[model samples]
Target: MTALRIDGPWFKDERGRTLMLRGVNLGGSSKVPFSPDGATHNGDRFFNHRDVSFVGRPFPLEEADEHFTRLRAWGFNFLRLLVTWEAIEHAGPGMYDEAYLEYIRAIVEKAAEHGITLFIDPHQDVWSRFSGGDGAPGWTFEVVGFDITKFKETGAAIVHQTHGDPFPRMIWPTNSGKLAAATMFSLFFGGNDFAPETKVEGVPVQDYLQHHYIEAMVQVAKKLSGLTNVIGYDTMNEPLPGYIGIEDLNAPGGIVKLGSSPSPFQSMLLGSGIAQNVGTWKLGITGERKVDTQLVNSSGVNAWLPDRECVWRCNGVWDLDANGQPTILRPHHFTKVRGRRIDFSDDYYRPFANRYAKAIRSVSPDAIIFIENEPRHVSMKWGAQDAPNIVFAPHWYDGFVLFMKSFRSTLAVDFRTGKVIFGSKRIRRSFADQVASFKQTSKESFGGVPTLIGEFGIPFDLKGRRAYRTGDYRDQIRAMDRSMRAIEDNLLSYTLWNYTADNTNARGDQWNDEDLSIFSRDQQTDPTDIHSGGRALAAVVRPYPRAVAGEPLRMAFDIKKKTFFFEFHHDPAIEAPTEIFVPNYQYPEGYTVEVSDGSYETDLVTQTFM
Candidate 1:
């Protein structure tokens, strides 16, 4: 595989052919520890974080060939490979997991052998496994005065490990506004400005955390930068702003209002052992609304360790008053830095992104930096001051389908206006328009750089696992086709959310009740066939222009019609023939091609049209 470089909105290969960086996230289960059976449902040895490992996450090296073969057969030449900060530096600060690093190198090398190109995705959610999601190491909480064991009791986080089975669907996102994750994200991104007094080993926690995280990724670069298949590195995955831009601490600031919806002040107060009746919410068809009030931390469980006080309290964001009662000191601590309000992406995320890019490129100078901010937020605009070869790699998902775990092609709700869309055509148009808005943002905000939908997909276990039970994937196929149509309409490059080799319908992606993996072990009836357990193969495995000779004008595939249409202008300068992957699955009985001009040839064995 030849190395790729960004040329305006298209990825150009070494042969000057425009390339599409399209594929799937290596796996979803890579988020948790491979050992300790750390699939969120099992709380066994939950806090024994330092001793865990993630070497076999997507799969052990022994099974790499099988999974890679499947992905290759699906026409995935590019991958957004998932790696976590906790996976690398879980032992302690400056302690790199050499074995795990070697394992990743082996995986990358193996992927290169399979002709797959990938960028390292430093994946995280909310914060870490102990904080209701996975990413940062457990010691990150310990060093900053958090007791991981008490997160659940104090209502600081909704941990699936301790919260046990029947964990509410998509409730893990609520952790972004809770005590544990919010505090960690706040300190990680804004500790220097927000918590100047709080330091780790005489250095500000923000600096310490950032330094360690970038260096941890550098360890990966040290191991795999030499591999040609390793294309670049993502700055961070779906970064959250915590309380960075909240004007009022009394109201819920997150989009997700499920479970115990605690306000910023309430979360701070709860971490300090204050009892509060937090609003519990359930998402109705219209929107998320408060349903009832639940008394949280009635037993007075402090989230901070015995030797420490709340970072917010110590920083004077809140403190005790004359009557020995806690009171808010500065209500707008996060929102207003000095006098005026601050933009999270502009102020905090950009600086961190620059720093990370510089650090990564110091080792691998040619590494392209993939930039992404918190989902839904417009990140800082790039300029002469920022790093070069940067790609705007933000994430998106069909919110309705993802959260609700149900799909109806005929019914759709507009996210911006909250208006209901009717009919299949209108619904499809709505999805395309939404994605077009995202692409237009990249053009207007990022100075016309290349863009990739770093993550987007539907949950396979929709409507109480109907497809899994009946083995009829019509809904799954339709849902997937709908998303792919939007991507194709925009001609945008993307890596679908996942391809978890060890995924099972029961455990989901093995964490947080998310069952988005295209393949699952539970559905694998035939071990001899590589594509046995694939869900919605009709839509997922489809035809596409692999390497265009020149600028691509339009691309579309009608799944129902079993037809693909692509239009592009050929660049006469490049003599290399154009390549399109017309999958055998789409036309297993054989097919014909009609070109506007020039000659063409088809290779059935390689599944290519040249």
Candidate 2:
């Protein structure tokens, strides 16, 4: 469990072995609060936001050993650990929760004891818990003159608490194109230019927002500053550009359209209390469609505070005509600056990333920075002047399987092109090629840095929760195996979507009705068995070379055969043997191994073949 450093396209250990890191997102429920039972399904909003605590997010101190031991046994040496700005600064701006910071420090220390390494992921969904996702605190919107409670009525954003139970499936993502999230993100990233008139306490919105967010993370860095296992920090999880690059505000701008879908201009009008006939969309086997139009904000509820005005209106993106109707004054306001077209990744994301990288590295100079690109968009090209020691950490998902919660080995969709490819072999190739494209992007865009699939997994409660009822997980296994093959074929490093300690069959990950977690308490039928609650272990706990002495040329594992193969050209400069993880779950009956040249020893306790 030595510290790792970046070596071009590979992560090298203290022994100079090219390390292939396999890890998982520590847990999914870290998105919400632990107290007041803030699970999205509960629909409770009485608790004060400032008084909330995240002391026991991934797990409590006493339960750390149990979760960590399980993860270590599963052969995970890395973690894309989840944290949130709300957890750090929910009390208000510059009001650091010292107790929670101490709790996080203890958690990181315990993880180090388990031989696990991790980077802090400032995880977020659309924007915040009040906006149908989780990341920023509620007060963030308040400072910018937003009333989160009015979001639901105005169709500014959707919230589980206000939306009530049986929330629409996979609809939370649509919040990105809504009024609440789009406005906040635009203000956070580009308020100086777009919302020139917008300010918080006389400070420019962009500077005011970014400064506080970066400082909140800096608090965590200061707490865990000296811990060697605290490898690095993620800039932000799935940062969106809001309306930054849209050429037309009238056109739809969301990726997954469900329920009432509004254009950027329509969202602004709705937030400003103007009723609009927004299109209602539904997802079917054929894909998304505009089923009908729904009149939103009929009661005329405004999303802004009582004394505040719409930021866009003040900036002249829209205005009230002589007839008291909102009119689009600048349809392409976000598309350009001073008559020059803008690229969201280049103009906005890169500058923020650079600022974030500088802020975090001030604590630990050698700390690696894991960069996640905007969803469905390519990362901006990096030059010699860009941040160093970065890894192109991107996210991918099988759209058909993820949303539909159904899998067929013979059928898969190329989400990039939205075309169905109907063949098992072709589907597998497409999956592998999809991952390879990211690696290629790393070479071209990020100057040949290492690539990590920050997040990807399957829904355990798939096929209408059949497994939960019948206790059969063959479908989940097949689906997970297919995904693992894609990664293994590419020989890429990755952290699986998640493992939530408190996950249940009914509640899923306890946020947004997503059941992507690989572990659930209800599935734990045997208390003594460490692997009982694990949803799909057959494909998950497979053989992988933990450390290669030189350049790894090839690697593969046969799920059916239970046979493993790995090859690498030895480095004469460093004479350390390659280490392979041979999990006992895949080999219960004492297995044998053969090497091309030298003999290897087995450590049954650690489950390693060196």
Candidate 3:
């Protein structure tokens, strides 16, 4: 395998043949530690952060061969392998885990044996495990004067471990807008600007957090520097904006209003023991709607330390009146600095991304930098000079299926326009057009760089976990097929959301009840069968052009008819034969190949048709 590089909106191999990447996220459990039961539902070890190990994340080194072989056989040559900030420096600041680095190097060596190429992903959701998701360390909260144990009582965050059984489905995302996550993200990205008075160990909180994060990843890079299979690193996963540019903290009707919608001011007061009535919304067949209002965090527990005020309060954004009531001192504090409208991307995210790229390249000059925008916001103003060697890696999901957890073949919702589309023909077209928009953004905003759909997949436990008992995965198959078809329709490169080595029907992805993994041991009734452990294999395993002789014009796959079609204009300058992956799982009895005007051969062992 040759090292991949960007060449004007396409990936080119060492021999310079245009390449398209198709892969899966190595594992979902990479977000949590492998030892001490770090699963989010296990609340016993929430605060014991220093005494943990990530030795077996993604999978132990001993079990790497099995998982890597399975992924390669499924026609995945590239992988978005997950790593974490906590995994590297869980002990504390500046303490690198030498043993974990050795284990990771061994795993990368194993991946190379299967001809697998991967880029490291510093995965996170919301913030950290202690605050409803996973990514940063627990000490991050403490250093900022937060008490992790009281996050729930103060309505600062919602965690599955503390909330207990029958967890509220899809509620973890709301934490991004809450006090704990919102404040952390604001301080992490804009502390020097938004909260000038806040600091951790006498250093600005943003610099402290971002510096530690980039350095931790640099340690991994230094260990895997000479490995050709380890190509690049993602800056971060799903970066959030965290109340950076809100006009009014008391205003409602913001971008995200899933459940318990609270304004910035409301969130600040709620965390300070001021009970307030917040509006709650619910998702239904007709989209989201406000159902009722409830007074939450009624226990009046403050999330901050005793006598230590909120970061925003300490900055004089708000204050406690003489009667001990919170009052808004500076309503326009975050909205503007000196009469200029603040854009989180242009002002904050872009600078941080550039800084990360420079730091990583300083260690390994040839490493590629993968960048992503905020999940809910529009594309930022990017340019060629922003980062030298960069790949535009943004995530997209079928809003209807992802949020509703049900498949509707004839109905689809366009989240951008908020219009309900009808008919299967229109639905497929809508999906393709929506995905194509990402490529357009790359060209228009980022100088026509290579685009990869970082994360996209369906929940395996859709329709209330009906497939687990019945063993009928037709709904799951249809949902996955639709998403894959959209990707194929655009000739786009992508890495599916995940393949969890330890996923089960009971626990889902070890974090936040997400069951998106394509493989699970619980379904592996027959160990000898390579495809038995897979969920919805019919849609997941399909033919794709691994390497093209020229620019690929079109590619499509039909799941119901079991037919594959690819069309590409041959480039006369290239002599290499275009190779396509023909998985045996998709064509059990063998199949015939037809090419437009070329000689081709088939390798049965590798299941590739040239």
Best lDDT among the predictions, by candidate number: 1
**Candidate 1: worst-modelled 10 consecutive residues by lDDT:** 411-420
| TM-score, per-candidate, Cα-based | 0.99, 0.98, 0.98
Q: For candidate 1, what is the total of clashing residue pairs?
A: 1
Question: 136 in model 2: Cα distance from truth in Å?
Answer: 0.3
Q: Candidate 1 residues 91-118, lDDT tens each?
A: 9999999999999999999999999999
Q: Could you tell me how far off, in angstroms, the CA of residue 524 lies in candidate 2 after the best superposition? A: 1.3
State the weakest 10-residue window (summed lDDT) of model 3: 251-260
What is the per-residue lDDT of model 2 for residues 1-610, given as tens digits with 9 covering 90 to 100? 7779899999999889999999999789999888767788876652367778888898888998888888888889899999999999999999988988999999999999999999999999988998889999989999999888799989998777788878888889999999888888998888988999988899999999999999999999999988999899999999998888888899767657899989999999889888999999998767788889989999999999999978899999999899987789988799888999988888888999999999998987887888887888866878889899999999988777888889888888886777887889999999999888889989989998999999999998788899999988888888888888888888889999999988988889988889988888898889688888988899889889999999898888888888888888999787787888999888887789888887889987889999
Candidate 2 Cα misplacement greater than 4 A, ranges: none
**Per-residue error (Å), model 3, residue 556:** 0.9
What pairs collide in candidate 3?
A: 128-133
TM-score comparison, 1 vs 3, better candidate:
1
RMSD of 3: 1.4
